[model samples]
Target: MKDDKLFTAYIKSAEHHFSGWDFSYITDTGRMQSELLPWSYGSMAATLVQNCDAFLDMGTGGGEFLSKLRPFPEVAWATEAYPPNVPIAAKRLEPLGVKVAQVEDDTTLPFDDNQFDVIINRHESYSPKEVRRIIKDGSIFLTQQVGGTDCIQINEALGVPANDEFAHWNLHFAAEELLQNGFKITYSNESYPAQRFYDIGALIYYLKAIPWQLEDFSVEKSLEKLYEIHTQIQSNGYFDVRQDRFVIKAEAI
Candidate 1:
């Protein structure tokens, strides 16, 4: 009882190319939307960047967000663990006097201890100890992370469990880890925002973009559930999911 045409279209949507951390194809088109968070991580980072002597952006995918924070300090560096994003980030950030490094291990970063005055991360993984070691005493580390329960509704609808490894990664656990690693949490906030998909295609594209959301995701495997969600959307006008997000500003002590 599958609608052949619709299934084919959803399958095709999953093939859409996603680069860096950009989701403009769906976000810009208004096909998918996530509600705004209470705090602005960008504004907070920009203020820090204005006064810092040395800055670092960890897990800077394609340097898309960092490039916008102009008027860089004398020493501005970005690191990307994903191989493909390193070149893209370099091409965009180097001309602006930002050096991009390809990093493999978060525990052992490339920089020297007490190197940066400020560090910013957006939805990137980091070792609390490494962050403390790299930043000078009294320096700041600001990060906006995707929490453990992020997009749980999507996984439930698709009949899959969320990634167990990151299931315990929430604001409380992260802040405690930072404190244990010689950081004092100065600011912290956690929120579950609503993300809506107006079409099945947008949902498929999102799943493809974030492979870790549903590790075994494949159009062939999820087609039936995708169709069910598609039908729900047809009836209800949209499919809504929850986004788990938290921001922390910790000072190295």
Candidate 2:
């Protein structure tokens, strides 16, 4: 494609509204794709939900993934820190009998002590102390986190400075933190999977959707680098990057 066409695509992607953790637009358009992890977080969460009496889902973005795991426990609750996702989560989860709470931040949990038998968190920030306080003794805490090195190649490709905010967010560190917080780590695993983007538009959309990836990212600001990547994609069919992910299952002792 020509430079003008590439510029148009980047502009369109930058202007697109990205709400609710959904990435269907890029995937459906065949612009970006990622390989699935070996293990199924959804399956594990479903099994834990089935065995627990009360459950809480942390950072349930629009309740999209949580809603898929049907037949929740008797008392089901979800917390969302993002303001726009609160109502969306409620609308989707209320019918399933799950109460969605809008939380101010990740430091405090609103629920009472021993309120839940199981807590599932996916790519959400949580306070270890709050989790320990809210969950019953011997309760389970399952979390799938995006590791610190996730998609670092995006920054490298754009010639931008790397962000070290999550530099130590790995499975080992997370497990150690849980242990220090009086939890027994039952399971832990980490993976670096490959991701591919077919077009500059998709890359722009992804960066825009996940602003933290490149906090100051903008189409105009990164035009030259984006064009370079566009040329690379045209020659190689896609631009590749590695995604960091980790899973942890801990039990309150």
Candidate 3:
């Protein structure tokens, strides 16, 4: 389950979602509802990141998670591949003392090795080797991934076998990669919580933002399912439509 196709498609869709908003003027005031977003890795970092001096934030989108680490860590630097998101992240984080970098080339990082005591990857599009190269020995690396079941759970109702059954991102994949690269897997866990879409239109908009659901989707038909879900939401106020996620902690050996 390489998930190459899903990644390719999803990146484009995510770009579209980010495109609609101007990051510089983001509404700075949504009280955090629960845990991180659909694919956040904060729950992983929370357990092991205490009292670190320097940190590297990989794939920092909108600077949401990077900003949270400010109080516990003295310095936090972030790298984002999406140029549109970089300035937005910088605008939000720099005000609070976090440094930001725009990663132009995919293969290399601008930092020196052994520079970060803690490294965070919420949803990385790059290779783990690149992540390994950026951190020093004894540093901690934490990631929160869209659970392996995320796609399957969504597509099962549609009677489509998950495109890459084995490809869903999860903590185990990261742990194995880290272990092979000389890191010790320390902790991992899953949180089950649903993010609701009030209407089928909203659900479609949400689906449009992620990959995999782009091709072969019948928007009108999916909207029917959305209406049913919305009806349930109207009665219950929330739906159990959640994406599973795995939080992981590993230490560079």
Candidate 4:
């Protein structure tokens, strides 16, 4: 007999509305726990923008993190590619003197050459040549990217193949790209930190929020595998996965 109550709970979690790159629902409640990386991307971004005249935050989803970086530069601009997030970012950032623009292509940013003194990207895709063009000479381009192997355990558990599109993206690959595109790599780090889900509901919520993890994911389709995971969690108290992350700081030549 199936556990109807638990299944209903999981369904509700999967239906939950998530916005603005915020994972606080599960994180703050301790339902999902992710270990900290060795380096802090926010702190590094703050340091890079200090006393700088102009700054740009690539893929500023809902301006959540960017808005928190107070004491902005004279010209603070942010770009959001996702349509749903564009209005959210503009609403949150514009009032704070940060102009938020909707971007369609990462390769074609709406900015003049050498416009920004500092460019920061957090888990956002970018064209190396575009970054080099937008950033001033000797300026900084800091990015913390999600590695290609991020959270493979989930895919394995769900019997889904991992997304191979960016499977080659790693610290070395990113740094070398920057080196080839008129930038000098200054700092780089990579880590596979532990991530734990205390309940099946939280896992459902996570997969729902991050659609790229399993592009074809749906609760109905993965119900059996999800139930298997739920049983594992029930017996072990949590499901563990490793999060692949890498950071790069490069200076435009």
Candidate 5:
């Protein structure tokens, strides 16, 4: 029954978002390929898999984390806020029996109380009230968030304002918020290592995809910025893109 609703939601969302042009390019362009976005997120979801079953992958973009979670064959359902995320994710998660929820509004999810054993979010934005209700006590809520100071250099190079207003790694604040709401954090891992990109074009595409970065949307401006990055990377071996991310595996009381 849950799976049925998920499919219905995904289709409805697709119908709504398909009104625009080819969104496939967002995830399927250039040498990078949108499909590979998940691996870069992290492989730490494996830790939760060994501990629980019946997973919920909120904001499961292109089902990238789902790729690493093949071992946990528990009943799995995914919720996505965007319709564009469905068709792209289906290619990776459909064969695995993962159903997609296509609801666009950001409300509490349509899950029963205490329904899932292991809840996962790879940058899925969820409300505190919603997460509190659906996740069971003793179950794990695993999140992979943008590292603090995620991509300041990229923004600076493009003359864009860089700040952590809504950018990634803001989850640490959110985690604290969840804690205040009666959750206990059992594990917290954060890393700030050098994440590299192949070339300048890839870096520019990354800028477009990453939220919270300044973008003029002007073709000429973006082109000029791209040229600058290209020259810089060509002079250097590759761009030293700083990747900051945090992992929190908390237990709901």
Candidate 6:
């Protein structure tokens, strides 16, 4: 009966609305946590931004991360592909003089050729050709991508199929693609860090928020699996999984 009540509570908590790309609510609870990589993406972006005259932030969801790096260049722009996050990003960035544009997809950018001196993308998809067209000669492009195998254990535990669309997404492939697109790779690194879920609620919340984790994830459909995981957590105190991430820094030739 106690386990049943906990399950009910977790299911109800996971049904809340999640918007934008912010995961502060989950992270703050300390119920869901992931190990950090050795390199700091924010510091790297800040250093590059200080040297560039114009900058662009791709997939600047809710302008959460970009807004922190203040004293922006005279021209700063941001693009968000998710419809729900467009206005949220605009609201947070417009006052700071950042132009936020909504893009239907990552393949094409709505900017003119050689428009930006520095382009920063975090967990956003991009077209190599499109990036080459918008970045000025000798400009820099830095991106930290989420790898294909991130959190595969969750899918395995839930008995759901993993998304293999990005199976080839890694530091090597990304660097090669950028190099082929006329960019000289300067730095590349990849890491597999461990993530832990302290409770079933946190796991459900994460799967719900990150739909791609389990494309068709639902409490009703996965209740049996969820129950099994809940039992495991009860005995082990937490469930652990690995998270894949990679970073690349390149300069346009």
Which candidate wins on lDDT? 1
Better by lDDT, candidate 6 or 5: 6
RMSD in angstroms between candidate 4 and the native structure over all alpha carbons: 1.1
Clash count for candidate 6 is 0
Model 4 TM-score, 2 decimals: 0.97
Q: What's model 3's TM-score? A: 0.70
For candidate 1, write residues 58-171 as lDDT tens digits.
Answer: 999998999999999999999999998899999999999999999999999999999999999999999999999899999999999999999999999999998999999999
Question: All candidates' lDDT scores?
Answer: 0.93, 0.89, 0.63, 0.91, 0.64, 0.90
Compared with the true structure, what per-residue lDDT tens digits does model 3 show for residues 1-253?
A: 1244532332233333434223221122221122344444555565445567888778888787666654756667888877778888989888887888989774688988678888877756556676678788988888776665664545654445665644646666767777888788877777667554433334444555554643466555554454455556557754445566777778888
Candidate 3 or 5, higher TM-score? 5
Residue 49 in candidate 1 has what lDDT? Answer: 89
Q: What is the lDDT of residue 20 in candidate 1?
A: 89
Clashing residue pairs in all predictions, respectively, total: 0, 0, 0, 0, 4, 0
lDDT of 5 by residue, 209-230 (tens): 5545664543246656656565
TM per candidate: 0.97, 0.95, 0.70, 0.97, 0.75, 0.97
Comparing 1 and 5 on lDDT, the stronger one: 1
- Residue range 1-253, candidate 6, lDDT tens digits: 3459887887777766787887776788898999989788999998988778999999999999999988799899999988899999999999999999999866778999999999999999999989999999999999999999999999999998889887888888999899999999988889999999988888998888888888877888888999899889999999999999999999999
Clashes of 2: 0
State how far residue 187 of model 6 sits from its true place (Å): 0.6
Candidate 2 residue 179 C-alpha distance from true site, Å: 0.4
Query: Which 10 residues in a row give candidate 1 its minimum summed lDDT?
Result: 1-10
lDDT of 6 at 237: 94
After superposition on all C-alphas, the RMSD of every candidate to the true structure, in Å, is 1.2, 1.5, 8.5, 1.1, 10.9, 1.3
For candidate 2, give the lDDT of residue 41: 90
Which residue pairs of candidate 6 clash?
Answer: none
